[model samples]
Target chain A: MAPVKNGRYLFNEIPSGYPIPGQTTVYDESETIDLDTVPLNGGALVKLLVVSIDPYLRGRMRRAEAKSYNEPFKIGEPLMNWGVGLVLRSDSSSVKAGDHVYGYFKFQQYEIVDATRVLVLENKEGLPWSAYVGVAGMPGQTAYHAWKEFAEAKKGDTVFVTTGAGVVGATVVQLAKADGLKVIASAGSDDKVEFMKSIGVDVPFNYKTTKTAEVLEKEGPINVYWDNVGGESFEAAIEYAAKGARFIECGMISGYNTSEVYQVKNLMKIVTKQLHIHGFIVTDLMPKYNPEFYSSFVGRIGRGEIAYKEHLLVGLERAGEGILDVQSGRNFGKCVIVVGEDKA
Target chain B: MAPVKNGRYLFNEIPSGYPIPGQTTVYDESETIDLDTVPLNGGALVKLLVVSIDPYLRGRMRRAEAKSYNEPFKIGEPLMNWGVGLVLRSDSSSVKAGDHVYGYFKFQQYEIVDATRVLVLENKEGLPWSAYVGVAGMPGQTAYHAWKEFAEAKKGDTVFVTTGAGVVGATVVQLAKADGLKVIASAGSDDKVEFMKSIGVDVPFNYKTTKTAEVLEKEGPINVYWDNVGGESFEAAIEYAAKGARFIECGMISGYNTSEVYQVKNLMKIVTKQLHIHGFIVTDLMPKYNPEFYSSFVGRIGRGEIAYKEHLLVGLERAGEGILDVQSGRNFGKCVIVVGEDKA
Candidate 1:
């Protein structure tokens, strides 16, 4: 077999604030991978299909010594994230050639990865390949488990979700609305706001134009708050939180790439309002709720009963730009980089 | 029968910061209550025994228009609080003359209060009357329920408690210690630190002399934080919290009086560390947990198995000074004003 041209985004430098796509993530397209003869060593050789570029990846662009829930992207190596891949060759019984798999993988077009890192997944849903790494995958499971465990919103309860057009936030907004709760959600752009409204968000606004506190003061005293982009909006949520409100802290995308983190001045309201603020890493809940989530959401998402919008960057070469777009709030929907063609 | 001399503390002025002992609270000792002839319309004429002065009262010193969990102390009226009283005369079936009752009452030597405002309690455990308003009362219940519901801690878990010498904090320290958790507690003074140590606190520090962050960084990465004084210490707690740490926000006494509320810069840790920060009003839990708390703690407290320290101010004339001491963080233990003697 011919040596296939491989493109990869290498972690070249640790970033201070927002990662500079070209310098921080050096896209090297000159490399080649001989998939037919590469060493498997009880592992699998995977051709990357669709890769999810999420805001959480920004947290990994730090010094190796700094501690966080996710490991820092190592310098001189490929940046890593959850992505869908087609297993081309395998020495492990867990995966075979031509099987679709999803898990943590390198930000490269082709790679030899340990079997443990990838889980063989059957895309019976006929949804887009990106859905395997996104809405029906990790982010979907995150939204599902977090809302189930913490949101605790009852019928007629008012919920406010930030980043409502993004994958995780939009899922929670829909779930909240499905439970007969009034959903107030925010997005960065007018288009995203419209998308939020299209998805049954009772009150949708572009946070870039309107102040979050003003909107919340008028329409909320939110019973439940799904926090995705935490900063000024987080402060507002705390300010307008109803007594016994629950704040599900899923992500803080706003603070991830910035040096000047917004100071929350109204935490005293947490005490006065008797609020419950819960933060959780989805992976922690995966062992307990992943199966439940797959059973609950996969079929719904596939049949078009639950909608998942994808902002696709059609090549691995665009992975760096896609991540930057996500961190800067420029990308709408679930941002996914298509590394290779998916076989129908 | 002769009219009895009555001394009371009136809410004379709304305070901007800390309430002034004399100006904000006007001590009126000229009024007299005719004990024999005063009408009790379906209520009780009670002689106040011991009254609790808490930092929460500072929140009520605001303008009447300002909303809070508690009502404002109306101008020219007596300041009200939880107190133990003797029912000198009763026109209600709930209480008879000579029975000891506990409830919300004015900071006066004598008053006629509605029956619904008080509950008759027989001190079968023979604890001090001050205990009825202090350790064995609302403060104790606050500590008990807040800890049981939110602490969610296990043995060997490192716990940090602020205001460790106060009634609620000390009780929590003891409870955490009883559960075999490592307790690191802070107090305002060296004397109070000694009291914390005496109450089985593993590490006791005088926050006045030592920086909270420095101590926490050295001794912590605390698993549970019982936040009574929320300001600099609360920020320190967030910074040093272990993964999935639980913060029981029982009170934010540090912010109750000041206009300059502490701006927390590290709430992003709430997401990264997967923290659970819970705020609750103990009163909300009372109907369900109050009886359980008394049955569980009263016998232990009475037998001296569970220690309670009281900071006593021995007269109705000292009520203003007592409340000032409490709000300023100057008073130690349970700040209780002994209004009248308890008949043994």
Candidate 2:
């Protein structure tokens, strides 16, 4: 290796509107990879095999005055994000070199990282390795923990999910269904709706055409709404939500690109029905309570009690396309970048 | 005494828009008050004094076929609603005559009610009787229970209340204040802002001038948002709300009159922050769990540890003005009708 160096995609400038082509402004390719030999505290560096593209990342690229969950992507710094990787070398006791793990690496081929913010890809032989990046990964955990911890979902209860075709959403729909709740979802396209139905959503509505209020009225009432897409969908969910409902607002993807949002018509439904709407960060939920939740969830998936679809993209070079696809609702399931297959 | 019969304000026609001046017909002056003398089994006759004129009532009036908190107002019959009254008679032995109570009364002066759903109001003299209709009542309990039970508020937490000058918002501000939370409120007018400040809000902003997100950013993070005025206020609250914040949706007054509604930006904040925005109705909170809460609440009010303000419209004749004032932000506090004083 000729004088190893950091390889990362920097946020050149904030994107306007829906982050059109070249809006992310991926920087130059790295001259040398940030190898494991670097003086990182806990573990050796790893080469990123697959990176995840999420719609929420667009929010961080904007010029925010204060920091949110992870720091807002700095104007001139490489956009910090989550990824799956193969450890090239190890310095920590828990994880070893060549061990496939899911961690928050940079948007690059290789990253010098600490082991604290990582999972050892437990039950690796027990489940698909890529699953550690999909349903078994952050997206999977997001849906599972949110539905399990907050929504207070019970069997026979009705559960509605906004953006029900996305990674977190699809996962929520299946999990809620597995729990014996009648699951309903809102997707951007008719195709996504059909896809959602195939995966066990009792009803799937195209948010673009079907009015959220109309669907809720048709559906009558829902006990919990696992929100992955906010805005008009949220407002609609407010109107249709059952009495004493719980709204776990996981994301508001619908309002990310827009400057303003659609208001809810029957917001008072919360006070009158005794509904609980709470906002939380996955990172806060992850270490604090996700272990037992995800473990059981993964068990559900393994036992065929739940199901999901995977929308995969090939090559690290296709990372930009994957991100764009997610932002546009073109990716129905987990949009993952395939760098290479793990031989571990 | 004339032939006495039960009276009720019936929904004559669905309101296409705000009833055109005199389009809202009233049945205040009536002598045939009681519908029947013999209490039918499972039916109770309630003499209602104070009825809630909430913005949500407007949605229930729309001609569209849909299920709501209550069935939509029939084309020519009475609208069943929330109110406080004296139980004139009860067919069920579970309740006795002359019991102070509240329930879904017909929007009228009196009605031979079905007793099955009646909730007896016990020991209500500790606080202002009007509070049973406003704060310490539906609106007040709405604010307190949702904040305490759903939001799980803590001292030093920051709370954001929309429509802070309105009945529900006012109660939320006072109750959240008692809880030692830093409270910021959104008012439609400068006077309302001042009123909110006088009542107890740490800071009050005119929603028309200052934006919720901008002001919320300056006030520090919001732990909970009691939303009564939906639209821009709610959208901004989602963006500006702190991590792990709970948003209690109570009403959508801002766009209740218009065909068009305001849109929000940054809905993605909900997922990233993991926000819970719940829509509820107060009738569902377990009465068994609320006695202690009500007692402590009333004690605080009686001791002046918590003080409340009421906007009383002298008679039922001006009920429209009172309702309009309450809806339009003209009323400075909880709007009520002085039907009669409490006497055994």
Model 1 lDDT tens row, A229-268:
8888888998888899999998888888778868777887
lDDT by residue for model 2 (A1-344), tens: 44554445667767766765445656446557435346667666677777777777886877767556766777656665567788777778777888777777677767767876676665633766566677777788777666667877689999888888877888888778777998878898888888898888888989888887798889858888777666667777777777778888777776676666555445545555667776666767777657686657678777765567777887665666777788888887778777666642
lDDT of 1 at A119: 80
Error of 2 at A176 (Å): 2.9
Q: After superposition, how far is residue A277 of candidate 1 from its true place, in Å?
A: 0.2
lDDT per residue for candidate 2 within B1-344, as digits (tens), equals: 33464444445555545643235535444456434454456766666677666656676766657656665667656555467777766777767778877776666666666666767777545655577776666676776766666677899999988888776787788878877999998888898888888888998999789877799889968888887777777777877777778777777777766766565545566666767676666656546446766667766666766556678776555555665676566777677765534432
True C-alpha contacts between chains kept, each model in order: 0.89, 0.77
Q: lDDT tens digits, residues B25-89, model 1?
A: 88898899799899898899899999999878888888888776778889999999999999998
Runs in model 1 lying further than 4 Å from the true structure? none
**Predicted structure with the largest TM-score when compared to the true one:** 1
Interface DockQ of each model: 0.81, 0.45
lDDT of each: 0.88, 0.71
Candidate 2 accuracy as TM-score = 0.80
- Residue A290 in candidate 2, Cα distance off native in Å: 3.8
